[model samples]
Target: MTRIPHEMSGEPNPLRALTLDRLRSRTSMKWRAYPEDVLPLWVAEMDVPLAEPIVRSLTDALELGDTGYPAGTGYAEALAGFAEKRWGWEVAVERTAIVPDVMLGVVEMLKLVTGPGDPVVVNSPVYPPFYMFVEHMDREVVEAPLGADLRIDFDALDETFRRATTGGRRAAFLLCSPHNPTGTVHTADELAAVAALADRHGVRVVADEIHAPVTAGGVDFVPYLRLPGAENGLSLMSASKAWNLAGLKAALAIAGPAAAADLDRMPEEVSHGPSHLGIIAHSAALRYGTDWLDALLAGLDDNRRLLVDLLAEHLPVITHRPGEATYLAWLDCRALGLGDDPADVFLRRGRVALSSGIPFGTGGAGHVRLNLATSPELLTEGVRRMAAALD
Candidate 1:
C-alpha cells in the first residue's frame, strides 16, 4: 500500500483519499469481521493511514532493534506537552502513570476508588465496555442516562450519585468525555457541576478521554481536572483513538492534585502491561502528530456533514445531531418502524453492519451508532444500504 503523505494544501480529504480496494485489503477487525459484501462501520477504528511521524518513529525503533520494556517518563511528558499546548491544561508529570490503554487505565482507576460490589456511575447510551469492565471487576454499574438532547442530565446525575453513595458507601463515576456513540462533549460548566455533585456525595470521578484530540474546530475540550473542586478526579487519556493506533496499546492515567496519593497506590505490576513499541508510537503521535490530527479532524468534519446530507437524502426518517467531537454519530431511527435493534436489520437486509444500540444501554434502544471515519464513497454506500434495509 502506498503511504499517503502528511496533510498538505490541495491534498484530498484523508477520509476520502483511501479507496475501497485498498481498505478491503487490510486485516483489521473493521475489515475482517464482516464479509466483503458488508460495509463494516460498527467499530471505532478510523480508516486513515498512520501519521508520518508515528510511522517514522516506529520504523526507527524496529530497524535499531530497540524493542524492550518501556522505562521512562517520555510518554507522559509528551502527553503533558500536548495537553498544555492543545487545551492550555498543565499536567503535572509526577501525578501521571502509564497504563496499558484507556480501558485498562480506567479499570485501575476504578479499583483505586471503589471496592468490589461498590457502585460505579456512568452516563448511558455510553460505550458498552463501561458496563462490561466494571461488572467483570465485581462492581455494580448505576446508570445516569443522558437527557433527551444526548447531553448529561444534572438532576439524574445528582440523584444517581446520591443513591450510589447511600449509607456512606464508596462509589466511583466513570466519565466518558467527548462521549462515545453519542459524541456529546461535556462542557466546562457541566464538568464543574459534576465535580460539585461528586464532592457533595463523596463519589470519586474517573474520566475516559481517549477521543480528546478528535474534536471538531471551535469546540473546546476541557480536562476534568482543570475544573475547581475536581482535585480528587482521575482521567485516562490516549492518542490511539485520534491517531488510529488502537493496535498500539499505551495510555496515561492522570491524577488530580488531591488524588496523587491514590494513584500512587496502584500496583507496580500494572505498569508492565504497555508494549514498548506502543509507547514509542503513542509518544510520537502526541509529540509531533498535530498537523496530521488537524487534517484528520478536518476530514472528519467534512464526513460529518456528508453523513447529514446522505441520511437526509436517503434515510429521511433517521434523526442525527452532529456531535462536536469524535467520528461516531448517534442516530435516532425509531420512526422507521424497525424494532429495538436496527443494526441487526441493516446487517441482515443490506449487509451494512453498524453498532447495535441495545448494547449501549438505556436511550440506546431504537437507535444506531454510525462510524463516520471512512471515505465519502463508503459512508454514502453505508447510508444507502441502511436506507434499503427499510424496503
Candidate 2:
C-alpha cells in the first residue's frame, strides 16, 4: 500500500484536462445515452481515469485467474482502515457484510428493520432510487422535504416520523448523507437531531453514506452511526462512488451496537451476491487509493467553484447554490420557464442532457441535477449549450 506523494504526481490537473472527443469515444452509459452531438452531464459517473491501485488489483486478479465467489474479511478490514484513518470511525468487521451494491444493501437492511407494507421515511428531492426501491419492496414511502436551504428540516422530519409510526408499526429512515441531487452534507448537529427524533419515534435509521469520502473542500461529513443515540442504526458505504468503481459492484452494510442483531439475521444468501473481483478492487481502493482520491477531490472542489462562475457568466437565470459535497449540482430552473421538466427541454433544444428533477419527488419540479464531475472544457460547453437553449 505505497502512497503517492502529491509533488511526485505528474498530472497538472487530473480531471480538468480531459477533452470531449476523448470522452465521447468511450461506450459507457453517459456517452451512449445521447447522440454524439449532446454533452451528457446527467449521470453520476465521473469522466476521470480509474485509480491506479484499483486497476492494478483488478489486472492481478484477472492474470491469476482468481475470479470466484468472494470470501474472507479483507474487504471489511480495508473499509475499517479507511474509516479509522479518514473519519475517526471504527468499524467492527464482524458486524459488517458485503453486498452487490449500495442500493441493494439498503433494501436488505430495510427488510431486516421493517416488515413489508411498513412505512419508510426519506427526504424529498433525494436519490431517485430511494423512491423506486422502497416501493419495489412493497413498503410505503414517507417524504420529509428538505428545507429551502437544501439541508434537513428537523421539524418536517419529526412530523414525518410520527406519521410513519402512528400505527405502532416500526419504520425505517433511509438517510442520504451529503444528500444527492442537492449535495447537502449533514452537519453533526443535524445528524444528532435526526438520531434523537428516530429514537423517540422508535424508527430505524439506515444511512446511505456512499459519498462520504468524496466530500469537497473543508466540509466535515458526519457518519450517522457516530452520533449519540445512533447505536440502532445501519450504514451503507462503498468505495465505488469516490473511486469511480461503480461497475465493479461491491458495497458494505454495517450495523451499530443495537442493530447488530438485525444485521446478523440477514440471510446468508444475500452475501453471495457480491462479485469477488469487485471486492478485490474495492479493497485495494480503500487500502491504497487515498492519494488518487485526494487528487479527485481537489479536482471536484475546483469544478464546483468553476460551476458557480460558469452559471453566472452563461446561464445567469439558473441559480446554483453549491453544496459542500458530491459532483452533482442542483440547479433552480424555475426562472427559465421550461415547464415542469427542464431536462426534457435541454435535451431537445440544447443538446445537453441533465437528470430530470421530477423523478426525485416533490420539490423537484422546475429543477435539474447537473453532473459536474467532468473536465472543465466539457462542463463549460454544457453550460454554454444550456444557455443557447434558452434563446
Candidate 3:
C-alpha cells in the first residue's frame, strides 16, 4: 500500500520510482497473463498508480452512492478542455458520442460510415484489434503496409483506396494516430496527406487516436479532425491509454463538421455500454490529471532512452527505432534467427513474455513488441532474458 508521490512535489521519474514487487501485486492482465517466473511486458497496461485526482473523484462518487447510468456532457467537455490546452486543438462537444472504449468506438464509427462486406483499409503492422474488430464485423481489411521507415505509404494507400472503393462502393480508413506497436506519431503534413487521399478516393477516415496523449520528446500530435481536408473524418479518443484507465471502459467518438450527421446516426443504445464511473474517472483524468501525465511522459522518455542503451549493450542484433509516442517498443528480431515469432522463443527459452508480432498483420513477422512502461530494472531484465533466448 505504498503511496506514489504527487508529480508536482518533484518526483522526477515515475517509471523508476515503482518497484517490481508492487507491480506484481496487481491483478491486471499485464501481470496476471503470465507466471511470476516470467516478466510480463506484453500488454498495453502501464505499471503506475492512479493519479490522485482520478482516485479522489471516483472515491467521492462511490461514497455518495452516485453509481448510475451516465448523463450530461461532462466527459466531452473535459476532453475538449484537455485537447485545447495540450494539442491546441478545439473539440466540438456537440459532435461527440461516448462509447465503451477505443476499439468499440472504432467499430461504431466504422458502422456509421460503412456497411457489411465493404472494404476497410489499415496501415499494417498496426494495432491487431483494428484487424480483428473490423473483420469480426464482416468488413474487408485492406492492408496498405507502411513504408520501410514505418510512416504512411501514400502511393500504396492511394492505390488501395482506389481498389477498395471501386464501383462507387464506400470504404473506411482506420487510422491509428501515434500508431501502436511502432509508435510513429503522424506529423501534421502526414495527416493532411491522408485527408487529401481519403477525400479523393471518397473513403471515410476513422482515426483511432487512443494513444494521442502519450507522445514523448516534445512531439506534436495533430488530431485528424483538425486538418482542413479532414472535414469528413471521425476520431475515437480516450484517456484510457495515457492514464492507465483501461479497466474503466469509456471513450469519445468525435466527428468533423461534415461527418456530424453520420455520427448522429449511431444507435442511442450504444451509449449504455460505457460505465458511469468510467465516464467520471476518464473525465477527472482529462480535467485534472495534467501534472501526473507530464511526469509519466518524462518517465516514458527516460525508459525510451534506457531501452536503446540496454538493447545496444545486451541484444545488439535486435533493431529498435524508438518511437516518439507510446510506451511500446517495436523490436526487429530478424537478425536473431528466431523465426517469425521471436516472442515464442523468448517466452519458452528465456521465460520473459512479450507480444508476438504475427497477429499485427503485414510486416509483423520477425518482430516483437516490448512494453516499456515499467521500471528500468524490469525492462533491463526483460531484454536480458530476451538475449538469453538467443543463446
Q: What lDDT tens digits, residue by residue, belong to model 1 across residues 256-328? A: 9999999999999889999999999999999988777878887888888899899889988898999899999
- At residue 193, candidate 2 shows an lDDT of 93
4-28, model 3: which lDDT tens digit per residue?
A: 2223434356676668888888988
**Residue 291: error of model 1 in Å?**
0.6
Q: List ranges where model 2 is wrong by over 4 Å.
A: 1-12
Pairs in clash, predicted candidate 3: none
Name the regions of candidate 1 deviating beyond 4 angstroms. 1-12
On lDDT, the stronger of 2 and 3 is 3
RMSD of each: 3.6, 2.3, 3.6
Q: CA shift at 248, candidate 3, in angstroms?
A: 0.5
Model 2 local distance difference test score: 0.89
TM-score of each: 0.97, 0.96, 0.97
